[model samples]
Target: MKHTIFYILFLATLSICNAQSELVKIEADTTNIRIGEQFEIKISVGETENVIIPKLSKLNGLEVIDSLKTDTLKNTISKKYILTGFDSGAFYVPKQQIFIKNQVYETDSLLINVATVKIDTTKVKKFPIKGIKGEPYQFDDYKNIVLIALLLISIVLTTLYFALKRSKDDQVKTFVPKLAPYQEALRNLKLLDAKLLWQNNKIKPYYSELTTIVRNYIERELHVPALEQTTNQIIESLFDFSDAKVIETERDTIKKLKRLFEQADLVKFAKAKPLAEDITSDRKIAEYIINNMQPILEEENSEVSYSTPVVIVQKPVIEKPNTLAKVVLILVTAAVILILSIGLGKVISMSKTSKNQMENVQ
Candidate 1:
């Protein structure tokens, strides 16, 4: 009886020592969860050196969603796994094997419960499905249409501007019967008199118009470009023409013209106000100049008629329209119409679809 008692004590001590020598431990953060819910499992080993932690690849009624790397701190190495269960039932995290140096260690199994979510159907209300809603229109939806409209307006305005400008220019260049040089000069002088310029204290304008008339007459009759020449230059050119036998003019006529020009220049450039009598005298002198040059003009015309028969012909100008611009405008207009039609059709179709959906819902 004493020997049997000692042997039983020795076996019990050995069993306790083996229980305390366990190196692998496994635990779980939670044991209860709803279906499709996740939990975590932690594994620890007391030894860090020469240990290999195996991955938890499979579980019963559960999935190993994630496996963490082994962590070492001081004398402990640990691993973690994220687990999720899809079925509502009790699941087991099976024992995991770990290798240490020359021995294999196993962790105890863990239990988990996954329950289905509960809902009280009596307290919950049911709702019918809603119809599809149409989205509100945005500026971006009509951006192309607006851009095309603006482009079309700009093109039309540009075309109109050019067309009107061309028409105005053509009107300015339209044919009008020209008066003879002498008659035109006389008519302008009479018009100047009717203006009452000097009487209205418009001295400079009066002198300017007076000088312009004489210059224009000389330019048209003698073809001397008198309008572009200075007063002194005109006198010199007239003397040259006399020397060249281009005109039959007396010294008196040239002197009178020189005096008129000098007085007009004084009024224009020096701002000198001429006396009323001097203005009247200048006007008379202008008429004298015009009449004096008549005989020379008649002589020239006779010589021209004797030499060659002249015919004056006036031709009308016709400008061709911009065919390329028209073609581009037509194409762009068509494109705009086509895009608008497509957009309208889409809108109508969407409206009909929405109406039908609403009717079905009702």
Candidate 2:
């Protein structure tokens, strides 16, 4: 009898353990939720060993927004689901099932309400549409535009500078120095000799050119106004110079020049032609007088001081600007500056006016 009673007690203990493993419970944070709002639904099962959790995607028109992992404390395992609904109405959380060791267990059904958020109409305020004010003008607003304009101006100025410099260079490249007075007179005489004008029946032209050479040479060598003076006037001037001993020349040179001038005046005004022999002889006399009338150098009677080779240094010759070029450059620069100044003034005035208008509107 005692053994039979002990066996029944062991069977009772096994049934109680199986019943505890099949127990499942569910709870929620709130029974009411606003439309589009979320709530949590937590489920707890009594045991984890050999438990097969049921998939619950949707319940009573409410969607499972998110599902958390199952958490275990002692032998109980709990799971939480984040749920939400968009439509406004009452919703029922239907019985959810949990399986353990192939045995099914269920939780109680629950009710929930979804409604729109309530607002007090009497407390709300109505506002009308407002006019937008104008924005204040700022220099930083046009920083890029101003910078670009200044850059362009710099480029134009630089281009003009280089262009004018290059133009000046080209002009300097083509310039030739003029021949001096004595060298020029000598060259003309040689050319006139080559012409042989008297042999070609051009005695008047020959005598005129010969007299011109003699007059120019006298003026250049002696600093006398021989070309502008009459033949008698030139002779008087030369006689004075000789009496003063200013020029170391013979009176015969003056007489020869006066005779050449008289012959030239007769040929040019009276149309008298001279013989070829007279023309040739006159050319020789003109050259001899020029050579003789040239300035003579005086020798210094001082002791020599040269130890090394003496290097004579001449002063640097500074070239002056051509009058016409200076005038043109000044005029052009003034015009450009005037145009730019006017344009800049207008731009500044416009900007100020625009800013004032904007401020007034605001």
The best candidate in terms of TM-score: 1
RMSD of 1: 10.9
- After superposing candidate 2, which stretches have Cα over 4 Å from the reference? 1-22, 35-38, 50-56, 59-69, 84-87, 92-110, 133-144, 147-151, 160-362
Model 2 lDDT at residue 86: 85
The residue-by-residue lDDT of candidate 1 on 1-362, one tens digit each, is: 99999999999987854653467889999999998888899998989889988888558799988888878889989899899999998878887788888678778888999999999999999998776665666788767867776776677667656653444332323344567777889999999999999999999999999999999999987887889999999999888887777776777898999999999999999999989999999999999998875335453457532223345544446665678866776676677667767866887688678777767776
lDDT of each: 0.82, 0.77
- Model 2 lDDT at residue 164: 50
Q: What are the TM-scores, per candidate, against the unseen true structure?
A: 0.47, 0.38
- Report how far residue 235 has shifted in candidate 1, in Å: 17
Q: Give candidates' CA RMSD values in order.
A: 10.9, 22.3
User: Ten consecutive residues with minimal summed lDDT in candidate 1?
Assistant: 166-175
Relative to the unseen true structure, what is the C-alpha lDDT of residue 172 in candidate 1, on a scale of 0 to 100?
28
Counting clashing residue pairs in each candidate, in order, gives 0, 0
